[model samples]
Target: MSDKLPQNRNNEEVDLLVLFDYFGKSINRVINFFYKIIKGIFSFFIYALKPFIRNFKLIASVVLVSAILGFIIQKTQRDVYTSQMLVKPYFDSKYQLVTNIKYYNALINEKDYAQLQEIFNISEEDTKQIISFDIHSGPENENDKIVQYDEFLKSIDSSRAKNISFKEFVENRSIYSGDVFQIEVFSHKKDIFRSLEEGLNTTFTNTYSVKKMQKRDSLISIERQNILSSIKQVDSLQKVYIDVMNDEANSNKGSYTTKDGMSFIQERTKTKEYELLKESMQLRQALSELDAQKVEEDVYFDTLSSFQDTGEKYTSIWRVYTLIFPLAAFVTLCFVFTGKNIIRFIVNYEA
Candidate 1:
């Protein structure tokens, strides 16, 4: 039995050995297959990259040429824009009144040629010079007038009129219900900014004045209603007192002596009430007068607020544009270059 057991153990050991050898062979076959596949792919990429690697100088020259062409094209065709400005009047907050946004928008859309010409200080003869008006609206008598105005804008000897529209030049283009205004002037020549600044300042000053007057008229109407309400209340109280006195006098019936004293008291009371009523009526009239003065003061305050808000908005909007445009251009350029270089490197490495 011991000998038989030893033989059995030997057989079992042989079977175990056979199983281990089979697994080792399988593993070796898999590893060799993968290794060969990786080597083939690597060789293929090396073969493809051999041409570009051999011509590093030529590739560098091509890239340099492309960059130079891009720079030159950008520099030569640069749009030389000249801008001039016209400022819309802001809403007057001191008067607690704001311009209707829809009305303001419509006013902007309707391009007032006459007003624009006046603001730009363009003369009729100068209007014949170099202006081209592209009216978005249908043809109207104003089209010719606008064309004339355009010519005048172009005729200005200052660089402000060159290669830019009055509309394009203004930095702030927002229309707000509350006090806010802006004007932008652009020109290829830096010299034109001074002239545009002076002209726009004057024009905006006049516009603010006119808008103030209109707001003043509206506020006056409100004050007038308040005064009228006070007057009506006084009149109503006076009527009630008068009716009470009449009813009391009609109810009283007695000897002349008895009635005399009561009549005196009643007369005294009625006189006092009448005097009070008269004073209140006078106060209403006085308020009406005061409203007139307040209207003028409101007009002044509204004009000042309009000017200040307009100046602030102009500064803020222009500052944003100055930062945004350059930053956007720079980021766009970086994205383009990084994407191109990364793709090129990846393809070359793979090849």
Candidate 2:
């Protein structure tokens, strides 16, 4: 048995040694693999940079010339002025507003100065100065986003709504999801924006929006009539209860037993005046709200802020051609050098 024990211990020691050897080899292999990847990447970058280094002077000259040309072009370009208007559309007028803004842009692109002249009531010369029109969702705070998310959840299936988080909902919402919008007009003439407003004002009154407003007004009228009828009924019941109480107070009968057809039970159940009064107040309040709603949203849209009389000069980083040209030149040179080298390699190949 002792001999067998020594032999078993020797076998276990050999197995452990073999396993250690296998693990050591794997670790070395992994380290070599990573080292080779890093070396290959470093060599590739050096090879790619060699062409730029060899033609440094030529590249510098071309970039400098391009930058100078771009600077001159930028200086010669006319200045653009921009102004913004904020509006809150009712009765789904925002859809028409966005659509009309796009139409205006299309007209500008087509250079239909005649149609533009009629739209803005501006002269041909003024219409020529018009550049572009843009619209986007206006500013909103965190509370507004949360309210919108809550409304969206209510509008969808409960099971689907459970899967949608507030962050996801906000990220997925489109421009039309917003209640307010900002309309921007770009033009060469600084004072052109204010004139465009009269045209934009006309955009909010589309056939669909007009019909929607009419439908809303009709619904409100019906609701108001129903609430008025309920109020009248409540007042009549209240008057009857008051008269019954007054008759009971004035009478001085000792028995005071009320007869219901033949039998007398001597039970006097009072009217629920408090509950009726509460219901009457609620109905009247609802009527007031309906009237207020009609008064508030009488128009298709409300102009939260109008365009400025004179627009401010518009500037953008993309318009900085001095920087743009040099970058473009460098990238073009890189592509050219790469293509030349590839063609040379293909021609000189011995396969």
Q: How much does candidate 1 score in TM-score?
A: 0.30
Alpha carbon deviation, residue 61, candidate 2 (Å): 0.2
Q: Clash pairs of candidate 1?
A: 45-351, 82-186, 82-187, 83-185, 83-186, 83-187, 131-150, 131-151, 169-184, 170-184
lDDT of 2: 0.92
Candidate 2 weakest lDDT stretch, 10 residues = 254-263
- Taking every candidate in turn, the Cα RMSD to the unseen true structure, in Å, is 17.1, 4.8
Deviation from native of the Cα of residue 186 in model 2, angstroms: 0.9
Candidate 2 ranges beyond 4 A from true positions: 1-35, 153-168, 254-269
lDDT of each: 0.50, 0.92
- Residues 1-351 of candidate 1: C-alpha lDDT, one tens digit per residue: 989999999999999999999999999999999999999999978865665576566656655555565556554642333333323243333122123223223433564445444544654333222122111111225454456447657667658667565455333322331232333332233333343343334422345566776776777778777777877777777788888777766765322345456433334243457676777868777786867676555433222211121211123333344344445554555465557767888889952
Residues 1-351, candidate 2: write the lDDT tens digits. Answer: 989999999999999999999999999999999999999999999988999999999999999998998899899989999999999999999998888889999999999999989988988999999999999999999998998898999999999999999989988999999999999989999998888889889999988998999999999999999999999999999999999877776666424444664444444547989999999999999999999999999999899999999999999988889998889999999999999989998999999
> How far is 197's C-alpha from truth in model 2 (Å)?
1.1
Task: Judging by TM-score against the true structure, name the best candidate.
Answer: 2
Candidate 1's C-alpha runs over 4 A off are 1-56, 66-88, 91-119, 122-179, 197-219, 228-351
Report residue 187 deviation for candidate 2 (angstroms): 1.0
